[model samples]
Target: MTSITKRKTFLILTSLVSAIAILLLSLKPDTAIMDDQTLYEKLNNGNTIYYLVVGDSIGRGAGAESRRDSWYAQLERLIKKRYGADMQGQHISQSGATAFEGLYKLKNTELIYPADIIFLVFGENDRKYMEPEEFAKHYELLVREAKVRAPKAEIITFIESPLAVQEFANQIQAVSSHYGATAIDMRKAYRQSGAEVKSLNRDQVHPNGKGYELYAKTILQTLDEFPNRKAPSTKEALYVQEDAPLHVTTSIETQQGFLYKEPYWTTGKKGSSIRYKVQGNTIGAIIKRNPNGGMVDVFIDRRYYRTINTNWPLVKERYIIIAAGIESGSHQIEFITNDHGHRFNGLDEKPFQLAGVISATINSKGTAE
Candidate 1:
């Protein structure tokens, strides 16, 4: 009698446990369906105007407490009210994605096809790690993919913040221009309106609701200004600035990274170096070729890595090298000039200027740009 009773109790407990497991499994959120359902619903709706946003934290509506308070949502509202268009929106963004990471997501993802408009906002997170040239290459890749995935869509890119590194914004604009997409410089628009930078900012990086509203308004205005035409080209040049977050040997100078300015670097001897300590899976730099340019040795952790020959005929900014697919953590990079010589363009013997240095956590391959 005891054995029979015990067996019945054990069977009852197993059934209960299985029931709970099934319930938990049913309750688990389905990520693929949650965001995609709205997209599919709108795609099937004949009266809907679809907009897709690909970006970082700001695109994900970080500072806004509610989804409706986010800038993209607000922008959709304005368009619906003003033009009487039925608006639908989707944002595919993670908190800390750089342009390369965003592109990676796009390559491996599936979204609604043939969107009416696409917004690409990134680079705030990128500037902390990637150099301008690296940023531009990845940005271009993202744009190219957007164009392919949504052929009928007009792509628009927005500047994240005025306080962000200026070169990164310019790089975004340049990428947009290259792809014939629209580029909206929100920072400049905010300044021209005489709004305090902090008034729109929720944190050191993200915008508050009020700020998001302003950003939406600005985008709408910009859209109206050029309803039928592609955005005008920025064609901004790349350069390095003095306040750039880099550590360098005493022989290096900080007078090359500014915009529309002459680049000048003077180091009297060999072993004069430029260094940057960054956290990412990639590292690179933007360098200007000079007539007097020579070989520069690259080292990681004092071990020889590679050598860069900066000698060329043209005076132009170029991405020197990118070491990608590394482990995530702090990394040390040193660029030491091995030989500096006098050139046809200049008489200086010890002068080699770098436009900028970039580092990032992008681990993808075939992203060499």
Candidate 2:
């Protein structure tokens, strides 16, 4: 062969190898690459490293066969094995919780203040019930609150599922970036793992045991990538105004059809109604859900707003946001039972129960009405 021909063949082969390398690099998980470990070592000192996990059902490890098989539990084990450090944390995530509900939980629940690390695993439920913009607003607020409470904590947000919508993932990435936190897009890791994403899920949403294992592995890999160890600075300009103090009231006005039960007002009669008045822009309800839970219509300022069906497969208590983004002032909220001899899951005569009401107004100076 001629010298020119040999050179041309070598050049072509080099170009092909380069293109393949680029493709593989592009297929890797979306995480920042860092080699420094000073902060990591500092956090791994002999003292216990407190952490917090906050989000939806996925965060609460719903589909795992047992608590030990959950992703968070597996991740804790991995951290202990790898770093030889003691760790402690709390998981305050609730099933069927949206971003708004997440924010409320963060505000109301007693968190581990000054935690060494925090994981946020929301967005799946938000994508189902909330607009992207509204979700973004609440998510940003949640992140900000975490920062304010745990200024020196390493905040990490997870794109929990492969089936998560693109918009919700984008919003999480954007908010994390803006707040100097790390956002791990697990979808990329799942796609690159060569596993069928559908097989990882127990149902349409929650992950099975095998799926949780994959989740833990992905999170461990991301942590190994040395994501930002620096915490958010309290001196930084705030993105949203601080929320007012939350007001919770269990005192409610009920008609004769309703009977007072410990911790809840229960009624099997149709047309039973309860009323609450509060001063706030955002309002929510604390209610019970069971196999026989019935539906209740919500009214704001005397106009029907939405209907809430408090039915679940098991007896579970939930704090749900029923109304938000209303004008900042006094408002009247009502919940009326609509039981009509409906049977759910072989249970007859579904009943309505109320636990309490929660509200947050814009004014910080006045008491709850």
Candidate 3:
């Protein structure tokens, strides 16, 4: 072989290698280019960090023996030890909350302060009743609301449970990417841990203490990888209107056959009803759920909407979404008690109770009624 021919082959191979490197770099997701030591140094600046957690049962630290054993609690403790920073956590999570419920709660509740970090720990309960698309819509709305409330906060979405489907996790990743947020898939960490996933869980659904430790470890490792990641600015274009109007009705209605019970209006007799006039595309209610709870038929603008059963195994207050995606305009919503012969612990004539009503418009202009 001639010297020129050998030199030409080497040049071609060098060019091919350069092209492969460029392609790999382009395909990689944008990540913070800092070492662990530098990241820890930045975090250990002695500044107080506020963390806002919003989601379902896992976010509320359910199934853990104590609050200290929960994932977030452990994460805070580890962050204090490793980063030498003080952390405060605020939780707005419910045990059986879905994405819709989470959104409703976020809308109704006021933030005490702007958060430094926001952890969205949903998907387990959402996957049980919501399709991937529906979950994405609600999740995106939740993220939008979080951004508006804390414009500079770092948003992190968690795919925390093994029971959550891949499709749900995919949607979470897609939405997070679109919003410049981060999605941490704990399933990957669980798989890499080489531990039996089922054994980590306390029961069929909730995780045990060891499982929560894994969750904290996974979150910390993921954060270390992207220490300088920023959440999307609220000034940027958002899927949801930042100033969307939400109307809440807490006043008692003067209706026949209904007894005012401090916070709620209770009626055991069938056909008893309460009405509220609200203007929005979405309607929800804060109601009481118990084993003796009965059925309530909903009416929108005097038209029959849907029947909601208020029965639960235990007595608790819940935000129940009555209807969504309706036309934006003034509408009268009525809930009529329709208790059939449903027996709970041999008790007949279940009662229906209403605490408050809420309505929200997506992008329409309206004032609270």
Q: Which regions in candidate 2 have their CA more than 4 angstroms from the true location?
A: 1-39, 43-48, 112-114, 227-229, 235-239, 251-256, 340-350, 361-369
Better of 1 and 2 by TM-score: 2
**Model 1 weakest lDDT span, ten residues long:** 240-249
Model 3: lDDT equals 0.76
What global local distance difference test value does model 1 have?
Answer: 0.65
- Compared with the true structure, what per-residue lDDT tens digits does model 3 show for residues 1-369? 999999999999999999999988876643233221232334656456778999888889889989999999999887888677777888999888877788877877888856778899888877765467656666778888888787777888888776558888888888788887878887887788898978788987888899899999888877667665455575442334434555788764446568877688888788888888887877889888877888889899889999888887777788866776677788888888877424565653246878888878764223232
Q: What are the Cα lDDT values of the candidates? A: 0.65, 0.75, 0.76
The TM-score that candidate 3 achieves is 0.73
- Sequence-dependent TM-score of model 1: 0.52
**Candidate 1 runs further than 4 Å off:** 1-47, 229-369
Rank order by TM-score, top first?
2, 3, 1
Candidate 1 lDDT over 119-225, as tens digits, reads 89887877765567656656766777787677657788988774468888878877677767778887787777687878878877888898888889988776566
User: Residue 323 in model 1: shift from native, Å?
Assistant: 4.8
Candidate 3, residue 189: how far the Cα is off, in Å: 3.0
